[model samples]
Target: MRTPAARTRAGSAALAATAALLLGLAAAPAAVAGADHRQDATTLDGLAHRSGRYFGSAVDNPELADTDYANLLGSEFGQTTPGNGMKWYATEPRRGVFDFTAGDEIVNYARSKGLTVRGHTLLWHSQLPDWLSSGTWSADELRSILKNHITQVVKHYRGKVFAWDVANEIMNEDGTYRDNIFYKTIGPSYIADALRWARAADPKAKLYLNDYNVEGTGAKSDAYYALIQRLKADGVPVDGFGMQAHLALQYGFPYQMRQNIQRFADLGVDVAVTELDIRMILPADATRTAQQADWYGQVTSACLAVRRCVGITLWGYSDRHSWIPAAFEGQGAALPWDEELRRKPAYDAIGAALTAAAVRRTG
Candidate 1:
């Protein structure tokens, strides 16, 4: 379709008002009185399941040691993605030498919780092993390396994961392809080759091209929209577009998010709100927390509005284990749960949105 830049930026104000109403209604006396009262009720995943979608969280290996955090994660969410376990650096630290220790741990944990795993990232520009990044390789050599990496990884986790993020963050903010190692060494066709290789390894697993800043209708998202169309026309196996909703309060909400999701869904592929976290300025106040909760509700509502928008996975479900503090200095407290594993305003907002969707489905 046409460029999203041409459309007017809309819907943020309306979504904010909607979230305020939901939070007011959902934050009843009983929900606020008891510390663990909400825990006994239907979870976010339980509500989402009514409308045929899954709710999930990303977990790092270290955080599994925290029993309280792990238990909440396992029970409240229906799916889990390893934040760094399935990445290239963790999976293959050396050339031709593979390790599945980290990924396997997450898969086993997810299985125990009856949560399906989402294989994150077969290919990415960052977090590559020293060997692969340090050495300069010809196009053919890098292509072979990519194929082998994708093939082996997908083969290993074939039936375990429901989907594979075959290629990630491949596009730049301006809708141009990023000058990543794969693009620089193997050219633009590397993405298609990676998808094909993964599909060959596991035909049952859904293949996706994932990236951040694509939740809105803009140049970055427009790039993916065009790229997916081209891939489909070429008979490539592309199953979904992942909008890593790593939102920030300063950036405002994604422009026309629901409409943007609909456009992608219309293109005949599923859309997912993968890696969701609404970060605010450090030392959050009531205003910032409310805004964060509003954004969370808006995202949940947008995904629920679309039939093909399959699921949402928070980057991390709690502030205790968030990557935000380290990654985005001076900015933290991005998740729905606090450091103590207590539900925050955002949690109630998301719950309200999911609850509303469930009611709509059964009503």
Candidate 2:
């Protein structure tokens, strides 16, 4: 999971210098163009924002000004979400105290721009208010409180949000359940209960179970598969699965990651490449950066090839504002857009993959 923090004064200075270099590169036409650039750019841009899209991102940092967001909205990208807006802590910081100001602003902004809004998360272990963690309430009281929170928040944004990650990162990486407050108080049944409450609040919204490390063969993925199968067998209202593709360059990307996605899609649920990003060290090496670009191309192509994979979103817009630098020590440059907001090779590679998909569709 990615965490955010203020950069150290020294780190900030280094980032500023890097940003200047990126800005200069972004302004250079030669850096922006190459063989088949125009055609690929057009196709990539079109497919990127097309309906049933291949690309998306979260709005977390203010560095992405309104104009920046406007430009992205005007492109082929048609979906937008507050990466952290719908989280439990961000929405309800105090007991029975709801704050929808930030989330409302994001939703209204995206809707006004004619973009689809994905409500990031209603339940998760991370980002929960401190109050919720303290053992103060009985099981019944906690259940009621949980229900009310879901009902109020989901009702508030009822019709606007296209989908909601109803439960997030509930299972551990070792195929067991994580011992969170919800699990301890409400029991394992809390997962289904939360989803049921959310659906009752807003029947129209698509509900999803979201998590990380479920992109490849592992205990976590296996656990998720079994859970989904059981839920479907019992007729649970789970509508989708959000595969949080937070990849690291050192891991060499997950082997047969797309096959894992296809397996989830086979369970008859829509699949989304949620929270996708690739991270690497600072003063990025050219060879490794190229490898990152190739990885992006491969990931995009895989999603395009699978019809049920409806959306792909970067955790952040650019390395400048990426959560990587602050969250993961010694790893920073991790997204398709560079620090200065210039399109990186990975950006072009993603565009090329989308362009190729669109060509195949037309051909």
Q: Please tell me which predicted candidate would have the highest TM-score against the true structure.
A: 1
Writing each residue's lDDT as its tens digit, candidate 1 over 86-123 gives 99999999998999999999999988877889999899
Alpha carbon lDDT of residue 210, candidate 1? Answer: 95
Whole-model lDDT for model 1 versus the true structure? 0.85
Query: Candidate 2, which ten residues in sequence have the lowest lDDT sum?
Result: 31-40
Give the per-residue lDDT digits (tens) of candidate 2, residues 1-363.
Answer: 222221212332233234334333223332121122123234343455443464667776253365554455334345666877788888999989999977887787666655568887888878889898764888898888899999999999999988998999999878899998888887988888888999999999999999987877789888888998988888888989998888887765675677888998999999998898988766699867776777777677678778788878778667766788888898878987775656777766676566556667777
Model 1 ranges with Cα > 4 A deviation = 1-41
